[model samples]
Target: MGFSPDSFYIKTLGLTNTDDAEIWEYATTNDFVIVSKDSDFHQRSLLYGHPPKFIYLRVGNCSTSKIVQVLQDEIDIISQFGDREAESILVLS
Candidate 1:
């Protein structure tokens, strides 16, 4: 399932250029999954565990299309990861 930034108050709350902590807090409060390529989120996931689960993309320096393709290809695995109770961080390489 695709999510619009507006649905999570990302645009409404003016989260542009905000720090990771604020974004994390919002995600936690709203029960939204964090999908990012940033290691900061990955580290936070490792430290805090979950209420806001994280999907860390390990793909290095690629075009936006490639990134989207990778995510599309792995949607099934990603869905499973999101649904799993014990899993919080999904590192997609």
Candidate 2:
């Protein structure tokens, strides 16, 4: 993976000029889900409403590898549980 720590928490799979709000917008627009450790994103998800999907990690202090593994473990279930009205967070432990 070419992901840096900054890229891990920040949006990286889209257009170069995209901002945070724009990233969120694009995710929804293109059905691309987000996996983030930032609580702010969870807040924004609620404040702005749902995109295609999102995973908000609440797990405390872990290395990037650990975080990636945790997310990979949950990837299959994400789409199964996806719904705009019912989901806004995905606290990984």
Candidate 3:
């Protein structure tokens, strides 16, 4: 996938237990997009909007491989979404 390591949630970043607000702030400051199944970010996007855009995974219970496959299938859509300045959150299942 040639993605340039934008996500900062690995254990090395020490964000394993960080709250949403802190994660939100980090993404905003660093121009990172937050991708998760957590609906908190969806609510946040509704209230705040843009800058640090988000991708909400409505993919109920599934393995990481399944999620990865979903993302791979939607790579074009995701790319288009990333390019759209007016778009903020993308809900992928």
Clashing pairs in 1: none
lDDT string, candidate 1, 1-93, tens digits? 233333343455689889999999989998888878899999999999997999899999987677778878998998899789999999988
* Native-referenced Cα lDDT, model 1: 0.83
Who is ahead in lDDT, 2 or 3?
3
Per-structure clash totals for the candidates: 0, 0, 0
Candidates ranked, most accurate by lDDT first: 3, 1, 2
CA lDDT of 4 in candidate 3?
Answer: 36
Model 2: per-residue Cα lDDT at residue 41: 75
lDDT of 2 by residue, 1-93 (tens): 523343333424636656667778777777766777767678787786566466777778888778777766776666466643577656666
Model 3: how far residue 66 lies from native, Å: 0.9
Weakest ten-residue segment in model 2 by summed lDDT? 2-11
Question: Least lDDT summed over 10 consecutive residues: which range in candidate 1?
Answer: 1-10
RMSD of 1: 3.0
* Rank order (by TM-score, best first): 3, 1, 2
User: Can you give the TM-score per candidate against the true fold?
Assistant: 0.83, 0.66, 0.88
Model 2 gets an lDDT of 0.65
